[model samples]
Target: MAHLPQVLVFGPPTIFTQFEPQYSHKYHFLNAWASSLPLDQFLHTHNYEPSSIQAILCAGGGTPVTVHVLSVLSSVKLIVTTSAGLDHIDLLECRRRGIQVAGAGSLFSEEVAEMAVGLLIDAMRKISAADRYVRQRVHSGPWDFPLGSKLGGKRVGIVGLGSIGFEVAKRLEAFGCSIFYNSRKEKPFISYPFYSSVVELAANSNALVICCALTEQTRHIINKEVLLALGKEGVMVNIGRGALVDEKELVRCLIEGEIGGAGLDVFENEPHVPEELFGLDNVVLSPHAAALLKSLPLICVTLWQGI
Candidate 1:
């Protein structure tokens, strides 16, 4: 027991609790820290006596772990995250501090992909709008809403063909959609048609879905030009980072009818969506719950064990 390493985890309590039953006797699990805690307070409580800690794990929301926090815990060897996304962590700082960082890849890919497909279908078929009408008891109006478009035989464009993007393409294929993709590099295993640029893909497809990672290079990649290319007949779905799409441009596009509609599970400024979006009936929005499912607890526990 004395030889085991002490690992401090900063995230939800459930993450540590679920995994503790399996590995508690082997390693020490320190008190959990919420992501909302100030960095200074977090460090004061968790790393004040840094000698007792040998590793750190960040498993909460997309908060950047500052270099100052890393500097205080010089003895920490590795940092493990339960999420597949790494944009929240400072990779350069970790490399400079010689702290290894490992993330869960492909673990949440299918979950996110399924959510994207669901949003796409809802947007195309106006499911949310229909549900709203029923709840409001607007029964007097004739059922003359514009006909819904079928996903079959439509040109579907996918941005970023990583694990999640591939999964989305596979599922969309079941509906007989012709898949097209744009990525930094082409994948040989994917049988879909490839586009060299996002603009071209948006201009050609009936639906455009964003599944790319959030990075300096990809920030606001889907701006006004891309939306304009995806004219009023085209629909858009974003299950990726909200920063990947320009919120201002999206709002303007939706208001001006430049594009048909959008299905969004994330936003540029999370937990604080723009007030203007609430009035638009064309958009379907969620509070970043795409990756959260009943299976998340089990998957998170499995990832903790491997970490």
Candidate 2:
């Protein structure tokens, strides 16, 4: 019998435990959380037998692949992540060491795009707010509820034209919204108007649906200036990442009525949402579970394929 290739992993137990049973037959997973020793001790012990491990699997952005970690795991030739965003990984060090990196590719694109639209409709139509009103016995009459903006004929701006962003555009277009986009560069094949700047995109559209990746250049891409550009009637839906927009500035914008509304699925800090947003009737919040819903099976299958 041959020894299964060792795969190192550092993340939440629930995520790894869920996938372990499905793929344990093909490889030996060295879960850092399950070790009796500390993570550093486990790494050093593994380093003693460098050839014993050559692959790493990271779920979400929980583990930081620092240069120090890469130095410890000297034999790691490949790093696989279940997340589409690579912000947590040390890409420069990976490049310097010639380690291959694999991601989910377009697997989560459709699911994320679907959620972006769902958030948009919920925010614009105040669907959740109305539901809350009915549940609380506040809906004595239909006119008691606040009005919502119509989805049709609204100008929609997509911050990225990647797979997820394109899917968002397609779905929004079918709903009679005019689509525009902003990317690093204007795509040659795309016919929609392209804005080189996010503020420019916000100025032209009634809503800005953020679907861009979080990179050094894109951090706080939607700032106070952009929020002001969005104005009092514009809505924002962020399905990509929370830090893509300045969360602090966003909170202020909402409180001061600088922007109309927001539907946020991701936050700069995971699992911790600002209490200020809790009171806003125009905003809808979703825990970063947009990509991992009833589609857990599909997500797991895609993750296995990526590995």
Candidate 3:
């Protein structure tokens, strides 16, 4: 048998369960999750020599590929992450070592934009809340239904006008939303109003959608001041990293009615959301699954081609 290229896998068991069958013939995956030893120890003790591992397959944002991990696997030349967000990986370290890093670059952009729009619509129209009321309260007593704001003619602000953000703007335009944006720098071709300051953007917008990359500069970019500027009638939607918004302050804002509504697809902490948000009618919460594709095979195929 030919010696297939060895690739170290960093992520949960499902990463292998979903992908191993298709790629097993082309590559030998050294799954770090199955080993009892620590990741570094596993790297040193796997049946194949560490030098044989020339690539890493990172499935999601959960497992971070730190500098230490890179130092241990000196032979690795490439790192492919399934997530579009590169914040989880130590990119600067990868650059320093001359290692190539790749992400799901525009593969999930359309779908994530769709998700942002869906969440925004749900939050603005109180669709989810209405559904709950119909399911639980329609038969009980009074026919009091909560009022929701209209999407048309709303001043919508998009932070980080990258691929996904652009898609979001295009979709929102069809809904008659007046699009405004704040990015690293203004794009010359675009005609939408630009705000260099996010706070200023929030003050002008009826809704704010976060779709930027998460960096040290962008961490907690949607702070209390920004939220305050968004005001009582504003809606906040986050399809970007959870850290982009101060989760604690967001919870407080929701509880105290500092902001009108929120549609959150990401949070500062994973699998753990602030309990205070659970009861709010104007809040829409998603399980950080905005980029989930319907066809599993297409996803794997895209990820493989990206590598």
Question: Which one is best on lDDT?
Answer: 3
Taken over the whole model, the C-alpha lDDT of each candidate is 0.81, 0.84, 0.87
Better candidate number, 1 or 3, judged by TM-score? 3
Candidate 3 accuracy as lDDT:
0.87
Tell me which residue pairs clash in candidate 2: none
Regions more than 4 Å wrong, model 1? 1-36, 45-53, 59-61, 138-146
Candidate 3 per-residue lDDT, tens place, 47-166, comes to 567777889887554567988888878888999877788998999999998999888888789989999999999999999999988888636778788789999999999999999999
**74-117, model 2: which lDDT tens digit per residue?**
88889987778888789999999999998777878888899999
For candidate 1, report its TM-score.
0.86
Task: Write the residue-wise lDDT of candidate 1 on 1-307 in tens digits.
Answer: 5567778777545455655677877787665465456655665765545666777777535445667767766787788887677777778988987888878777889988999999999888888977876677756866665566787888999999999998999999999999999998788877888898899999999999999888899999999899999999789999888889999999999888899999998888766788888887788998777777666767766666654
Off by over 4 Å in 3: 12-16, 33-38, 41-51
Winning candidate number (TM-score): 3
* Per-model TM values vs. the true structure: 0.86, 0.88, 0.90
Off by over 4 Å in 2: 1-3, 12-16, 33-38, 41-53, 138-143, 296-299, 302-307
